[model samples]
Target: MLFTQAKGRNVIALTTAESLATVTGIAIAPAPARIAAVRVKTRGPGTQVTWNDVHSFGPDAVTVRTPDTIQGDQDTTAPTDKHHDPIGKRLLTETGQNLGSLDDIDFDETTGHIKRLIMAGQDIPGERLLGAGTYAIAVAAP
Candidate 1:
């Protein structure tokens, strides 16, 4: 059994099922290999997601880089100054009121764009708050 390291955190196998077998040792099997580029695609607080390796043996793994955090584009005005945190620690109402804190955010699967902002509220609305799509979210802090 032999292995080679590619890029920064990837391993290239030199035998049939080698990569898949290696991955299986840790968890599940790997997907077939394809010639393409590897990228993180998108990132948020506590999480750094990866996209189709274009060269991996599995359907990209959304590795959890950190915990208790969310990711979104900055430069857009939040409900308030508190809503201008990278990890989203504050929650603002459409009427300029502090409702609760931000728990996490969700994104569109295929596009890797923001979908919703999960707030840490209880009696206000659903556990999962809705978003106005990426256009509504900017990577800038308020």
Candidate 2:
């Protein structure tokens, strides 16, 4: 699913099917290129859970093993210092070629792996993603 579309999905517990929070954002880590954590809105400051804690990423909701899986905001930091925001970051190639601006990321919710990168008129495969910094998202040249 598109990360953008999954933003509002409910975060629930698998055993009880209880809704814990609403998905607000996702933090991704580069290098291996996978989701590091899922940020959500709870009654408190905020909450997040690591990808390993995620039991399933279904169409309706994301499931976790238990409520204990959720972590407070203090434990959830930026996926990395360089990549703060996933949406609207400028896109650039490793060779310094400009692609465009990032629109949304196509990711496999279950595995937390990116599948594609969406832009104005191009849909670049996720494997092309190299890294992202505050300034721009870098992709490898084809």
Candidate 3:
């Protein structure tokens, strides 16, 4: 499913129907190009919902086993470790040619594997993903 499709979906607690947070965005770990963590409107990690914390990514909602799964601000403190979230970052070639801004990502809902990246209307396969940081999302030159 397209990652954009998940934005705005409610984050639900598995033990109850209560809404914990709203799906706001995600951090994509590049090279392998997978969703490293899901960002939510709430939760203690300053909007982060680590992959390990997610119990399931359902069509209607994202589920967590418990509220504790929503981490506090105590995880990895390195700023460099948080550079992979690439929603609106510019897309660039490995040689430094600008492609465009990344609009969205197509990924497997269950596995979190990125399938392709959507920029404008073009689909760049996930394997072409080279790297991601706050500056740009790099892809292999065609």
Candidate 4:
């Protein structure tokens, strides 16, 4: 599933399947896990939630944080890890063939691990990726 699709989906509790909050954005860490946490914008005023404390995630929603205690993070604060915003970054093969700009990321819904990169509506396998830098994603030649 693409991260874009996960955004805006209602976050439901795993145990009860009860609605908790709405997803706002995701924070990707530079670590091997890829997705470090999720940020949720709750329904009430002054309420927000972060999924950093949670350990488990499903395809559609996460199974953490209740509706009442979920608090929001400072809007200006950024994630503390080294990260890259892949969207709009150019995609290139090892031999320098231009594919397209990155559109979205495809990830494992169950494990929260990034599976592939979506560029020009195509799926590029994670293993083919050589490097994801500030300007472009270098992939192995086909």
Candidate 5:
């Protein structure tokens, strides 16, 4: 399992499920001898819940021993790859305002991949505020 940051949020993946349903297939594969399941763990001050490794394979069945008990399952949901805005593409605001163009992306330093866009906007005095609020900055797409 792998833990990554996407859009300033943590993304959990058993395997790279970017395309072709990659992670889902591997998770349901026949259990290996030593490796039972893949567990995705999030570590940091802002994240939540930690435990010993969890098996990726689903349990056959379960029955509650005590009354008023609940059962929960954990699995990594696939990442969104809409690709509406291609890399280096320019996107405008809903109000038809020239917000900015996509610059580069900032990835998790530990993971070494893109996490957020490094948008560069026009050099207006007040415009900096707009850029600061945006995950995508307004700059010439390169």
Candidate 6:
């Protein structure tokens, strides 16, 4: 799901199966990989959660925050560098062949890594990436 759509969903603590948090924001890493982390707000005094530790995702809720899990960094919501946001950027091959434009990203919830790039209704494996910057996302020629 797009980060824009996921912003306000309820965040459920999996261990308790309770709704204790709401997704507040997302942090996109400013590199070719576009690793993303979610920021969640809890109902306690300064209780905030941030990480890619999503257990399951659904239209109604997202399960997260395990009992023995350490909370992720709070400052990951903001980008740390000058790299471009990949969404909407053009998709091209290393040979300069135009494929399409990036539409969304699919990530691995277990490892917090980007798994694929969704572009023009097609799935491009993250391993095919060559570079992602201000211009476009270049992948290996297929």
Best by TM-score: 3
Which 10 consecutive residues of model 3 have the lowest summed lDDT? 73-82
* Model 4 regions more than 4 Å off: 13-18, 31-33, 43-52, 65-85, 88-99, 127-142
lDDT of 6 by residue, 34-134 (tens): 45545566655323344545676576787776733324454444431234556677989988899989887776554546667787768987778776666
Clashing pairs in 5: 37-56, 100-138, 106-115, 107-113, 107-115, 119-137, 120-138, 120-139, 121-138
TM-score of each: 0.29, 0.84, 0.86, 0.56, 0.23, 0.51
Q: Tell me model 3's lDDT, rounded to 2 decimals.
A: 0.78
Which ranges of candidate 3 are over 4 A from the true structure? 43-46, 73-84
Model 3, range 19-75, lDDT digits (tens) per residue? 888887777776677887887777454456788678899888999887766654356
Best by lDDT: 2
The clash number for model 1 is 13
Instruction: List pairs with backbone clashes in candidate 3.
Output: none
Report lDDT per candidate.
0.27, 0.81, 0.78, 0.62, 0.25, 0.63
Count backbone clashes in candidate 2: 0
TM-score of 1: 0.29
Candidate 3's displacement at residue 41, Å, is 1.0
TM-score of 2: 0.84
RMSD of 2: 2.6
lDDT at residue 87 of model 3 (Cα atoms): 78
lDDT of 2 by residue, 14-88 (tens): 878788898887676676677788878877554788888899998888899888888875665545222466788
Candidate 4 residue 83 C-alpha distance from true site, Å: 11
Error of 5 at 109 (Å): 3.5
